[model samples]
Target chain A: MKISEIARLVDANIYCKGNEDTDIRCAFACDMMSDVLAYVKNQAILVTGLVNPQVIRTAEMMDIPCVIIVRGKEPTPLMLEIAADRGITVMNTKLRMYSVCGILYNHGLPADEGE
Target chain B: MGALHLEYTVAPDDFSRAGEVSGIVKRTLKDLGFPPAVVRRTAIAMYEAEINMVIHANGGKITADITPEEIMIVFADQGPGIPDIDLAMQEGWSTASEDIRDMGFGAGMGLPNIQKSTDYMDVQTTVGVGTTITIKIFVTQ
Candidate 1:
């Protein structure tokens, strides 16, 4: 799935440009960075409400190209700077975490490496 | 092959700056033309080790040696050491404070996750001395 499609489907506001078309190989929804590290195996989109620099660090390490900040939570400036530097598309949606994940899952995005 | 050595000092308890060194090494791996899968594994392992240094140890120094066959990263910290390596290695066991968890870490998955991402890993510790963790990843993996 393209990153822009996620943004449109979830009613999200993309904070970074030029990465709208980045291919999202999978999706994982969790605020726990450790779980993301332990489970995410490939290019996955991180759906989380946690707004911190470590989130970006996690994505960067995992090579996750997109991060969706849910519950209308926007990322901090430092997070945005890091995401921009790392070429991660940061998107924010007003929908709760569960709804956002359901929408993406319904759209045929695999939740884990097994799929 | 001869390895390229790189070093960075981690400041204790600085959650904000914890993973900077790992990030740099991750980028360096890419610049050196490593495969994405191998690069991501190394970076994630190193990142976890680096964060553990800040949260558990009183911060530490990370030295990485990069070679065509493997990348080795050593994390040495001067803080209260791990009393039980077995427990520390267990999943869902952690001594991190609530503050650390609030920062999105301290899920007790650090060491285990590091082991999963690396081809080789070793841990050495003493009660008062500190802890040292070395993780190696093969390039051909």
Candidate 2:
């Protein structure tokens, strides 16, 4: 799905417009940056409630195109700056982490391909 | 022969700037047209070590030497060094504060992750003086 479609699907606000036309294949919903770093699932979108530089760091290292901050958490100025510099999309939504993950998963953004 | 040389100074206090160096290194590898697996390994190993430096040692300096055959990363810090390198290398032992843990780090996986991602990793640390970690990821040429 295009990052724009994800924002529309989840009612998210795009904090940074970058690579919006990139199609995301899968998603990962986790607040633990370690897990995100360790698990190489070819996930394209990272949905987490944690707002910090590490989130963007993980995204950049993994080449993830989009980051969704759930529960209306605001991205700090540094986070936005880093995201902008790296050309990674950032979005915020009012829905909680689990709910947002569920909605996106239901809409065909599976967290992983299979067991 | 060394192909590309890079150096970055990690700030001690700013958690926001933790991955700046690793990001640059990753981009450099990408621009050099390294294979995806080799680039990913180098990025992951360097990133984990960078996080460890930020959380455990306050800050440090990272030096990366990239060659066609291997990428070597040296992370040196002057904070209170790891008390027990063996224990610290374990999978679940962590001395990180609650705040660090809350940020989704300090799971005692940094060293192991670095080891896993790279072809080889070595740690040299002194309790009061400082610590320096050297990690190498070899790419099939």
Q: For every candidate, give the share of true A-B contacts it also has.
A: 0.80, 0.70
lDDT scores of the candidates, listed in order? 0.89, 0.87
Give every collision pair in model 1.
none
lDDT of 2 by residue, B2-112 (tens): 577888999987788888888989999998888988888888888888888888788999998888988888999998988899898888788889999899898888888
DockQ of each: 0.84, 0.75
Q: Which stretches of candidate 2 lie over 4 Å from their true place?
A: A113-115
User: Which consecutive 10 residues in model 1 chain B have the weakest lDDT in total?
Assistant: B1-10
Error of 1 at A33 (Å): 0.3
- Residue range A80-99, candidate 1, lDDT tens digits: 89889888888899999999
B131 Cα displacement, candidate 1 (Å) = 0.4
- Can you give the lDDT of residue B112 in candidate 2? 83
Backbone steric clashes in candidate 2, count: 0
Q: Which candidate achieves the best TM-score against the true structure?
A: 1
Lowest lDDT block of 10, candidate 2 chain B: B1-10
Top-DockQ candidate index? 1
Runs with alpha carbons beyond 4 Å of true place in candidate 1: none
- Give the DockQ-based CAPRI class for model 1: high
Candidate 2, A1-115: lDDT as tens digits: 8888899999999999787779888988888888788775584699999998889999999888899999999998988898999899999999998888888889988775422
